[model samples]
Target: MDNEGRESGHLMLITPERVFYAGLLGRPHQRCSGAFHVYVAIKGGLRLAAEGAVEGYSELAVVPPNLRHTIASDYRSVICVLIEPETVCVGALDLLAKRLAGAERQFFVGRIHAACEQLQHEPRDGDIFSSAFDIMCFGDALPRRILDARVVKAIAQIGRFSGDPVTAASCAAEAGLSSSRFLHLFKQETGISFRSFRAWKRARHLLHFANQDLNLAHLAQHIGYPDSTHFSHSIRRFYGLKPRAIFSGSRDLAIYRSGRAAAGDSAWTQEAG
Candidate 1:
């Protein structure tokens, strides 16, 4: 395992509700297919190509959930915040939809830029970063709670036991509801089916293992995949990248984890692959 407490330019802070990435932008082009991603150009503007539409230059961009998009930046550094849809309120989703629809542009500079600047300077202060992100993205520090009580319970269960084989039936049992009712409520509340949410969670959880020096089979099993094939396909479908590639790309990133260990505030330096 890589030793902890090494300082690096690249930083990644992972929380249950969101994931934040900052520092050297690395590759000129990046493509993703899952989650709602908010990208801010720290040094210069970026070029975005999504769904066959291209923007020549943009300081900030938002990619809606499951939308395949590519971001190209000439600048050496950028910051990204990935928020889960279930964690966002209807208003925030409305704003995001407008951006994704090309109805609005340049929505992230003022507050979000300040937050990114703070993160670049003090990468260890996860709370500050998260608060800033929430305000800039959702207009508040707390996400609006709109999910049904049972659906909320199921979502929490899926997040807590992501390594287990989480099925609608299992989650429904935890929420004290029938599988059919749980499925309906889950889709109605979250706007996505239970299976898709579980898949997204599993894929998102894979980022935690990115820095680990493990084989494909071991990594696959660690995330509850049945085999390497299933792992590769699932990751590609959700992230638009293969597991090996994602792991390889994350080798240089210094991970900062919250609500966990004291060593989570460490960093390490490595050239981008």
Candidate 2:
């Protein structure tokens, strides 16, 4: 993973629960949705301005899920932790926001910074990265599971068959519930509708094929989209960036843990920039 002369730098470690990104902020401004984002400045801080939200500059900042925002930096590097909203408790999110917005902004202090520094030295160390993230975000143990068991099963089914055209009724059947009950419970547990959750999962699945040199249409179809237009819209809606922009920015990315496959000796490979 040499990034000496690359236009943009990206090193990503993707686990089942979260994705860790340590990269240079190349795009002046970009929008991201779906996951809760924690941004830490490695060299110099970045300026973040969100729609109808307060603008601020700090070494660390937390963005809540589904909020539209733009980030800008003068070619500075950053470390971003993207946690799945369902994996975290709602109370913890409030606590994290207060901690980041506090006067001192001590969320990035102590072990968090140390762990991020360690990842900067070795981005492919998934175990260390996961441990550090657990300590930084969850403290002692993983966050308490707040989703209902049926909803959890439905989520797993969505991940397993993301490429297939899975409908709410199908998921409901898998969870042994009626369509209405499943939809209601799903929204109550996840804070998002089943349709929205499915779309997010489909969009997030694009990370797996980011490094491949495939056509946008092919990539779209591979991820269960009907065509390129639908694919483009879904990606832009969720990621706030076009499919090509995402692919180009990820050219030098090295993926660490892909859930489809086990982490092996050659799990880390740098795509040609």
**C-alpha lDDT values of all predictions:** 0.67, 0.69
For candidate 2, write residues 71-188 as lDDT tens digits: 7764456777787777666677677667666764664544456655555565554343333456654354334445576776677777764456888998888877889988998898
Which numbered prediction scores highest in lDDT against the true structure? Answer: 2
lDDT tens digits, residues 1-273, model 1?
123314455667787666777655545434554578877787778777787566557777777887767777778667777877766665676566565436344545555666655554666543434444466544566444355666756766776644567789987787777889888878988888888888888888887777768888987787788898998888877666677777776776777666431122211112211
For every candidate structure, what is the RMSD over all alpha carbons to the true structure, in angstroms? 8.4, 7.4
RMSD of 2: 7.4
Each candidate structure's TM-score, on Cα atoms with residue i matched to residue i, is 0.78, 0.82
Report the number of clashing residue pairs per model. Answer: 4, 0
Which regions of candidate 2 fall more than 4 Å away from where they truly are? 1-9, 28-32, 103-113, 123-132, 136-142, 258-273
* Model 2 accuracy (lDDT, Cα): 0.69
Q: Which one wins on TM-score?
A: 2
